[model samples]
Target: MQLWRRFTHRLRSRQAGDALLALPLGLIVVIVLADVLAARLPLGPSLLIVAPALTASFASTLVTGAIAAVAVAGMLIIGLDSHLLGTVDYGSQFFALLVVSGVVTVFCYLRERRARELALVRMVSEATQRAVLRPLPRQIGPLRVASMYLAAQEQSLMGGDLYAAIRTPTGTRLIIGDVMGKGLTAISDAALLLGAFRESAHRQADLPELAAYLDRSVCWNLAEPSEVETAGECFITAALLDIPDALPLIHMVSCGHPPPLLLRARQVSALRATKPAPPLGLGELTAAVYHVDTFAFEPEELLLLHTDGVIEARDARGAFYPLAERASSWTLHSPSALIRHLRTDLLAHVGGHLTDDAAVIAVQHTFRQTPTVVHTTDDSA
Candidate 1:
C-alpha cells in the first residue's frame, strides 16, 4: 500500500508540473500551426507569424523560446522534405524558415538588452535623487520647511533648479534660483551657484553683500576666456531670504525673479519686492546695489519660493498654469503634505509632464502657538 501511494504521488507531481508549463507551450504550438497554415494559403509569406513568435521570444526565457523556434523549424523542414506542397522546392522552403527563426531570435535578444539598460538607468537616477536632495528636518528656526524638485525629462536624474537653507551667525539664510538652460551645463552652473551661496551666506554680513559675492564668483568661474564679452549677459534670477532673531520679519532680495508667495489665513498674496534689482552677473558693470524687502511673518503663515519652471509649465491645451491662482487654496499644515499636494496638482495641471525642471519650497512659521479661549459667566455676581 505504501509503494502504491508513492507511485500515485509521483504521477500527481508530474501532472502539476505539466499543467504549469502548458499555457506557454500551447501558445507556441498554436502560433506555429497558424504560420504553417498561412504559408500554405494564397497569402504569400507568413509575416503575421513573426508577431506571436517574437512576443513569445521576448516574454519568456531565451531557452524556452529557442526550443519552440527549433521545434517549429524542424517541423517546417520535415513538411518541406515530404513534398507537402506540389512542385515547390524543399530547399528554398527550409532556408526561408531558418531565416525567419534567426531574425526573431536576434530581435528578441536585442529588445531584452534594451529593457535591462533602461531599468539600470532608472535605478541610478533614483539613487542620485536621494543623494542630491537629502530630506529636510521638521523645522528650521521658527519655520517648518518642505520642498519638492522634479526633473523635466522622464529619464533625467538632475537639472538646474536649486535651493539651499543654512543656519548662520547672520541668520537663517535661504536661496531659490534657476540656472539659464538645461542638461549638463545647467547642472554645472547650479552646483557652482549653490556652492557659492552656501559659502558666501555663512561669511557675508548682509543680503546685498552675499548677492554681490555670488555674482562675482559666477562671473569669474562661469565665463570662459572667449565668452568674456558675453559674461554680463548670463545671469540667474534668485531670491534670498534672511530671517532675523529680533522680530517676526523676513528680509528678501529678488534678482529679476518672481516674488515669493505669502499665505495668511484666507488670504494669499505675493510679497512683491518694492525695488526691482538687476539679476546677478548683470550688476557687476553698474555701481547700483540691490535693496532687501522686509515683510512681517506672523506665526502659522506660509511662504513659498519657486523657480520659473513652475510658472512656465504648460498644459496640453498650450495654456500656462497660473501658480498664484492654483496655490491660493492650499492650506499649509505640514511641509511634506503641502509639497505632496502641490506636486500632484501641478503634474495634473500639465497633464503629466513639464517642459522645464521645477521646484517649490513651502515654509510655515509654527513657533507662535494659537491661544486657547475660555468662557466666563458674568451673571454670577
Candidate 2:
C-alpha cells in the first residue's frame, strides 16, 4: 500500500507538471512529419505546416516551439539533399520552405508581441500591488519579518487587501488593512490607507495620533461629504502596531479589524486591542477616538497579522478556516516557512482560488543579551 501510494503521488505530480508542456511537444512531432512529406510533394508543403506549428508554439514556451521549428527545418533540408524527389525542384521546394519560414517568423513575432503584452500587464500588476501594499522588510531592527500576498483572482498581483511595515524612529511600525470592496477601487483605497499610515506613523508619536491621521487621510481621499450618509459605504478595517525600544512590548490599535495572533512556544493566542473602533473612513460621523492598547511580547514570540481573507476562507464543505487552530500544530520556525504553510493550507481550504486577496505578515523578535558588568572594587579601594 505504501509503495502504491508513493507511485500514485509521483504520477499525479508528473501529470500536473506536464500539463502545459504537452501542447508544444505534440505540435513539434506533427510539424516534423508534415515538413518531411511536403519536401517530396510536387507543390510546396511549407505553408501547410505553418498554422499548426505557429499555434503549437504560441500556446507553449517560445523556446520549445523554436526547437520544434528547427527540427522541421533540418528534416526539410535532409529531404531536399537526399533524392527524396525526382529532381531538386528548387523553385517549388524553395518557395515552400520560404512560405514555411515566413509563417514561422510571423508566428514567432506574434508570440514575442504577446509575451511583451503579458509582461507589461504583469509589470503593471506588480507596480500596483506595491503601490497599494508596500512590502515589509525581511529585517526591521531586532525583528525578523516575512510577508505573503496572494490575489484571489489569477493574473492579478494586487487586490483590496494590503499591508506595510517600516522601522520608524519610534520603533517598528506595521499595518495590515482590508478594503471593503475588490478590484481597482479597492486597490485605490488600500493605497490611500497605506500611504497615510506610512506618513503618519513616521510623524506622529502615539498610535492614536497615527490612527487619526490615517482616518483623516482616508475620509478626505475616499469620499465627498455627500457620500457619508450611506451606511454600507466603502471603508477599511486595519490593525496597526508600534514596537518601541522597550523590547517585548507592543502598542497596538485595531480599527474594526480582527485581532492579531501571537505565537509563543508553539501556541497561538489573540492579542486583544482596545474596543472596536469604527473603520477608517466611517469615523467621520461620530468622530470617535481611537484607543491604544499595550501587550507584552515574550522572547522568541511571533506576531501574525493577516487580512480577513484568511479567517473567512471556506472549504468545499463551507467550513471557514480557523487559522489560529491550524497554525497551532504547525512546526515551521521561519517566516517563509510559515507563509508557505499558510498558503498551502489556504489553497487546500478553498480547493483552488481564494476569491479574495489575502495578505499575511509574520514578525519574530529575538532578544539580544545585555553586557554583564564586572566589579573592580579592590583596585579602586
Candidate 3:
C-alpha cells in the first residue's frame, strides 16, 4: 500500500512538472517566431530571458539550466539570422542573458536545497509521530473499533489528540486524550500519557485505579521543570474505558473530558460522567478522586469518543458542530462506517480545515453469547 501510494504521488508530480514545462517551451517558440517574422520591430531577443526565469519557479536546477541553455541558443540564432551577431547591442544582450541565466540557475539550486531540507524534516516528523501515536487495531477483544486523528497544522499527520486500545484478560481497555497546548510540547505530553496508559492499563484492576495511575503519571511528567516550561499549567483531558468481553457494560473514568455519545436504535445520547474529576496533571494538586461511571453498552451499539475540537469546531455562521444531531441519523452504522461518516461530516462542518487537533474513536461491543437481562435506558450512564 505504501509503495503504491508513493508511486502514484511521484507519477502525479512528474505529470504536473511536464504540464508546467509547456509554458516556458511555448513562450520560447512564440518569441523565436516573432523575432524572425518581424525583424524590423523593436521586439529584441532579450525577451527570451523570460523562458529560464519562468522555468525556475517549478523546475529543478538541471531543468532550469537546460531551459537557460535553450534560451541562450535562441538568442544566438536570432542574432546570426538578423545579421547582428557582431553588433554591440547583440553582444550586451548576450552578456545580460548569460548573467541572468546563471543567477536564476543558482536561485533554482538554493530553492531545491531548501525544499529537500523541508522534506527531510517532514519525514522525520512523520516517523516520530508514527512511533509515538501508533495506530489502533480494528478489533480488540469483543469490541470493533475505528479511530481517526486530524491535525490542524497543514502538512502534519499527528498532533496533541491521541487514542489507544489494549486487550486485557477479560476485557478491552481504551483511552482518548488531548494535551493542553499545541505543537511539539503537546505531542510530547500526549505521547507520555499514551505510554503510561498502554503500560498500566492491563495491570490496573479497575477504572478508578487506572485513572488514578494515569493522573499520577501525568502530574509527575509535567512537574519536571526540564520537560515543561509551564509545569504548573499543563494538563490533559482524557476519557478511559474498560469494556468486558462477556458483560454488556462499560466502566468509564472521565478526567475533565467531554462525554462519549451512545448510538442505538436511531437515538443519540451522551454517556456523561456522574462525577468528573480534575484534568490529569491537576489531579494531584487538587487531591482529586476519580469516580467510575458504569454505562449500559449493549451489543451492536456504537459509542463515539471524540476530543473537544470536534464539538468546538465552528462553521461560517459561527455555530458549533451539531455532533449529536448529525450522528443521530447514523445510529445504525458500524464502527468503521460511523467513523467514516463522522469524519466527512466534521470536515464539511469546518469547511475542510480544522482550527485545532481532533481525535475520534468509534467502538461497538460484540459478543458471542448474549447476556440474559439487557438494559436499554438513556439514564444508564
TM-score of each: 0.75, 0.72, 0.90
Q: What is the Cα-based lDDT of residue 246 in candidate 3? A: 88
Provide the global lDDT of candidate 3 against the true structure: 0.90
Residue pair clashes in candidate 2 = none
- Candidate 1 vs candidate 2: which has greater lDDT? 2
After superposition, the stretches of candidate 1 with alpha carbons farther than 4 Å from their true spots are 1-24, 31-52, 60-70, 73-88, 118-138, 169-171, 226-230, 244-247, 314-320, 369-381
Please name the candidate that would achieve the greatest lDDT relative to the true structure: 3
RMSD of 2: 8.1
Any residue pairs clashing in model 3, and if so which? Answer: none
TM-score of 2: 0.72
Per-structure clash totals for the candidates: 0, 0, 0
Question: Top TM-score: which candidate number?
Answer: 3
Report the C-alpha lDDT of model 3 over 40-84, residue by residue, as the tens digit: 345658788899999999899999999999999888778878888
* lDDT by candidate, in order shown: 0.73, 0.75, 0.90
Per-residue error (Å), model 2, residue 300: 0.4
What is candidate 1's TM-score against the reference?
0.75
